[model samples]
Target: MPLIVLCGLPGSGKSRRAEELREALSAESGGERRVFLVAEVAAGEGGGGGRAALRAEAERLLSRRDVVIVDAGNELKSFRYELYCLSKHTGTPHCLLLCPGGAPRPDRPPLEAPDSRNRWDWPLFTAPEDPSEPLPLPEIRAALFERRPPPPNQSTRSQPLQAAGFLHQLDRLTQDMVAALMAAQRNGVGPGQVIPLAVEGLGQEPPGLLLSRAVSLAELSRLRRQFLSYAKMHPGEGEENLPQLGSMFVQYLNSNLL
Candidate 1:
């Protein structure tokens, strides 16, 4: 299924465009494909912010057999890129549909228009301000069908784990992922920052462990305790099980933390 991120500001009519795109996509796919229009950021299973929730929802939906339309202002270039990386990592074709001429909001970051030169923003479309105007359906379909988006090639910022990937290796026989992640927090990495399992360049920086949102210190502390307790019971011997343990713990955290 394809992923479409609707970009604009508070009053840019992203929701309406999202519905319009959803309907069009369903119709074009003859109702065979389920189209999801996300009007609001979903409440997270664990903890994080609204953006993290949206990312979580998108990741969940993208994993299944459905098309996703994210109806958010997506005001920051960084956020948009995050979605792009997720889609790529998931082997999902994605595009950016921008709604121009949106009313600006002082409370939000200024919108960063999608750049044609950037590969992630390719297959990008702009929704006309007029509600009656038609969306770029054919082009979008072509983009989705033309070819599968290449598998994630590099660890991008929004893709977090390139820098914060110590999670899978978190409980490496010699390394303490929790302590390192906490150290990252101590170094001023806050909510929504890439969560490094270790400090910069210290451990294996794989491409997938990301907290993606804000969790309270109490919550993290509790979660750490839970992981540590579990580790004590079944500490596997040798280095062969490092990945398995790290992966299991990461899954546990993602399941519980968000």
Candidate 2:
């Protein structure tokens, strides 16, 4: 079972989809295999320490499960790539499930979390993956401790923290990282599968609506249409009818990551 890295912005239904995928995979496995969902939000500490803890826990969980679904925003390319490297180090097949949400709205502001030094986010795990073989833990440790080279230029050495400035920076970073992933995909060195899913009406109702009173009826109505369309596309068992979505997931898994 591969480590399925859930990628998307906040409120893109990653956790919900993770549950659906877990159920689908387990059912296919005859209900005997265990699938664990490790949410980055639950990682709590913020910054590298938080990420390190999350990865450590994921590694531990992987040891005892048939599949491990890492549910996180993973908004940065470097972070996603770092995960790819970790999966390689552990000799586990890894893939990405890209979940893009609706257009960003000013009313729906992102959390103002502490900024992570992109260059140092994963100081201990910076190497790229070798799909053919996993590296030895001793060598990985040595690489982590060894001095790293300076950045090729100064721009990447620092970034502005203003809200607008940061969002633009994030946009550029995501674009670059996605392009790299696509290149790697073509080269047979990227994720096993880059599943693209656009989830509509994310902020309109139910969980989101309850949390945010700012959501207007118009927004809610629009969201309902989106959900209905999605549901129509995917009919499944139970109230959520997520099996349809699960079917799409399984179909993607069948494709070669290369």
**Highest TM-score against the true fold, candidate:** 1
TM-score of each: 0.58, 0.39
Q: Global CA lDDT of candidate 2, please?
A: 0.44
What pairs collide in candidate 2?
192-257
**Clashes, model 2:** 1
Report the lDDT tens digits of candidate 2 across residue range 1-258.
456676655666667767766776667669777778888778753554465667677777764246787887665443554455455445455555555563443432232221223222223221122223322334432332233422232232343344334334333333333344344445554233342322221112211001211223444344334323322221122323233322222222121111
Worst 10 residues of 2 by lDDT: 205-214
Error of 1 at 237 (Å): 38
Runs in model 2 lying further than 4 Å from the true structure: 102-258
Residue lDDT tens for model 1, 167-198 = 33443422455555666767777666666454
